[model samples]
Target: MSHDDGYGNDSGRTGDGYSTLGGTRQTRTRLPDGEGGDGYGPRRPPRSSRSLVTVVGVIVLLLAAIAFANLGGGDGDKGGTSGGSGGSKAGAAPTAATGTKPVTGKNGEIAAGFSQDQQGAQSAAANYSVALGSAEMFDKTKRDEILGNVIAPSAVGGFRKTLDQAYSATLFKNLGLNEDGTTPTGFTFISRTTPIGTKVTKSSDEQATVEVWCTGLIGLAGEGSTKPVTDGWFTITMELQWINGDWKAVTHSQKDGPAPVGSDTRASSADEIAGAVNGFGGFTYAR
Candidate 1:
């Protein structure tokens, strides 16, 4: 609503996203005399008119106050809850912290013994995504160990057979690593997955399906390297089952991303990238 400033002019927005005052003519209001005037004679608006103006002013102020409250209170009402379901609107993704502590136990280097809830399934999916995408998985021994730990017992053999074929010598060579999956001396092979977020698509006491959105660093980081460290976005979906008192992946698969556009930031040098990967530690994700 635009305001009239007693000159038949409306004061508010113009169509071009800017504010402007628009008027075609002046408007004059004549009123009865003396006391109710502007402390001068014959210029005062009538008492009834003055009351109506006061009421309108109060109503505008009240409406503005309500609008302001609504704008500020929307998110405050939904934050601090878990399960990726808290925000300004229904079904919105959560952006606030869940306030739940990360899992403390470890099965070797892998996170283990996740809580048997929706959050636990999401956490397990995230950690498994990291483990499966790690450089360790390029090595046959470590790869088998990781599968054993994260995969359900009934699915372990199938996973091992599938991964063995997937991580072939050609893949290692293409990634600038030795056929045996070791870093050719003086180069650091990076295959780390950092989970950006997680969502539980289906959940029950016995089984749950989770999708972990992740950003990954891969390739070799070193001076004069054939394959420089590059990043990619992808999502890994894992079907988890409550097996042997913990959540384990029954089936897991990857798909190419809900990717964001690349930024214009300059790429770091090989040594800087390698140094960063060495210096920084990885985190265990929680819901």
Candidate 2:
């Protein structure tokens, strides 16, 4: 995701993404009812009923896919994000450290004020990016709460409303969730972003620019989940303005991968990825 030491490009090359392109797992498929043999042929039950079920299934899948894409992306709105459409800005230097004590926060502060230190800025950018990208941000109730807690109150209303609209019944189903947001049978959906490294691009007293390089796991996890977990690397650069004291995202943007060579290991089952997401806890990072 990082614009390499010399490598470049994280510009949003969103190929025909999984959004409208996800393939469906055919459930309860019906063969043409002609030969009503015992085991070797299709039995004629009700042609109309079978057709109706197929149509319903198709409708459900379309709706679910829309919901999934909307919920999974454009959280900050496109206009507000930064970086060119080609790749990671040959942005200034990447921050090389994590966990360095912040130069601004008191020892016990959880949501501390802006830091003058580059390290602190990078940490702030990374954590804020995670919060902005989390799955909880798609659920209306929890999303509102988190926005109220982290973002400027003025943005909360718009963010909540837009996201609520995005995670509609159809969208949820398309994302492989039931209409009510529960996981579909035998599959788990992954949307985890793990930061590989961070860098402070620009830092001022009140506003800062930091970049987070992350590889995300996004796809359905489960036995029948055709969209298995796939990875996308990104460099997220946030323009953070210290608000009401603590840092908050004023704007952000993402691009596709600086994806390197693939690993040799077999991908985990949908259940495993799902279980891991359920079991793992995310960090409230600070430097």
Candidate 1 ranges with C-alpha deviation above 4 Å: 1-95
Worst 10 residues of 2 by lDDT: 2-11
Candidate 2 per-residue C-alpha lDDT over 118-224 given as tens digits, one digit per residue, 9 for 90 to 100: 44456666665555445554355665565565444443444343334444565455455677756676666555566667765545445555667766554566655
- Candidate lDDT (C-alpha), each: 0.50, 0.41
Taking all chains together, each candidate's TM-score versus the true structure is 0.67, 0.61
Per-residue lDDT tens digits for candidate 1, residues 49-69, read 222222212211211111100
Candidate 2 regions exceeding 4 Å error are 1-91, 102-116
Question: Which candidate leads the pack in lDDT?
Answer: 1
Q: Could you tell me the C-alpha RMSD of candidate 2 in Å?
A: 14.8
How does candidate 1 fare on TM-score?
0.67
State the displacement of the C-alpha of residue 250, model 2, in Å, after optimal TM-score superposition: 1.1
The best candidate by TM-score is 1
